[model samples]
Target: MKTLKLILIFCLLFLFTLSFAQTKGSFKVIVHKSNSNSSLNKVEISKLFLKKTTRWKGSKQKVEPVDLVDTSPVRENFSTEIHNKKVGAIKAYWQKLIFSGRRVPPPEKKTDIDVLKYVHENTGAIGYVSNSANLKNYDVKILKVE
Candidate 1:
């Protein structure tokens, strides 16, 4: 009986560890070098993602934000934790905006390296990528979400 109990406990602990492990990849929010210093609240960041706001009023430059591919863990995290919406809900919201011709989705990159490169090169760009990826060479700034 004692041996059986020990095995059960081990199984439960293993399952718990797997469930709470840091996601396979890291994620981070990056901004263009020009806007590196600009402080943005969660609302402003969400507005940008939803395409509700397009231009940076202060710089008079167009904003270019990128999103992770649909259903990706990073994307899911950003949508739910940062944008405060579920995946399906955010998708529906974007569809409506696209249909109205009010906004277009941001460019999607295959990997964090690509996102880092794109944001670093574009003056008005912003993107998210895994946190594990090294960002030493990029000129972009990483933003902290509240």
Candidate 2:
């Protein structure tokens, strides 16, 4: 009985640690160096991801948005923290929007590097990635959330 109790406690501790890591993982909203704005609030960033704010108006051009894969943990955290909704809900919103031909979702990449590359190469693009990603060599800049 004692061994069984100890095993149960260990399992619970493991689960708790996983949940803590999920909640603690850091994220960063990023844009190319050419973007004039250095930071944006959650609401504005949320709008961009939701297709409510489709373009970043430049002196003579528009910028697009890039996104991480739907299943990524970092994406999930971003959706929860910035969009105030779960990933599933966001996906549903996009589905409805697409069905109605009212909107199109941003381009999605499978890895943080892909997202950074997209934002780096496109002057008008913005994206997000894990905070610990190797961004030193890229022309990407982090956008502070106000």
Candidate 3:
């Protein structure tokens, strides 16, 4: 009986550890060095993500926003935490915009490393990644969400 109880305890502990491991951390929106000091509010950031605003003010260069697709956990977190919308709702919103020919979805990268590299090189780019990512070599600044 004691041996059986010990095995049961081990199984429960293993399940608990697995559950904890599944939880992920939040990511922060960041901008390329050229857009670091833009003073963008949450509304503006939302607009950029929604493709409502396209151009940078000082220059004619178009501002590019990058995002992960519907399946990404980071995308899900950003939709829920930052945008206050479910993933499905966000997809519908983008679908409407695309159907109207007003905007196209931002280019997507498969990983945070790809996002970091793309944003770092592009002057008018913005993207998000896990806050714990190593960003020392990149000249990017995290945007403060209002």
User: Which candidate achieves the best TM-score against the true structure?
Assistant: 2
Q: Supply the TM-score for candidate 1.
A: 0.78
Model 2, stretches more than 4 Å misplaced?
1-24, 57-60
Q: TM-score for each prediction? A: 0.78, 0.80, 0.75
Candidate order by decreasing lDDT: 2, 3, 1
Residues 44-133 of candidate 3: C-alpha lDDT, one tens digit per residue: 787777777888767757788898766778888877876789889978987887899887788878778888888899988888887667
lDDT of 3 at 70: 69
In model 1, the clashing pairs are: 26-130, 26-131, 27-131
Candidate 3 collision pairs: none
In model 1, which runs have C-alpha deviations exceeding 4 angstroms? 1-26, 36-38
Candidate 3 yields a Cα-based lDDT of: 0.80
Best candidate (score: lDDT):
2
lDDT of 2 by residue, 26-95 (tens): 6899988878887788998998778686677554446588878888899988999999999899989999
Model 3's TM-score against the true structure: 0.75
Each model's lDDT: 0.79, 0.86, 0.80
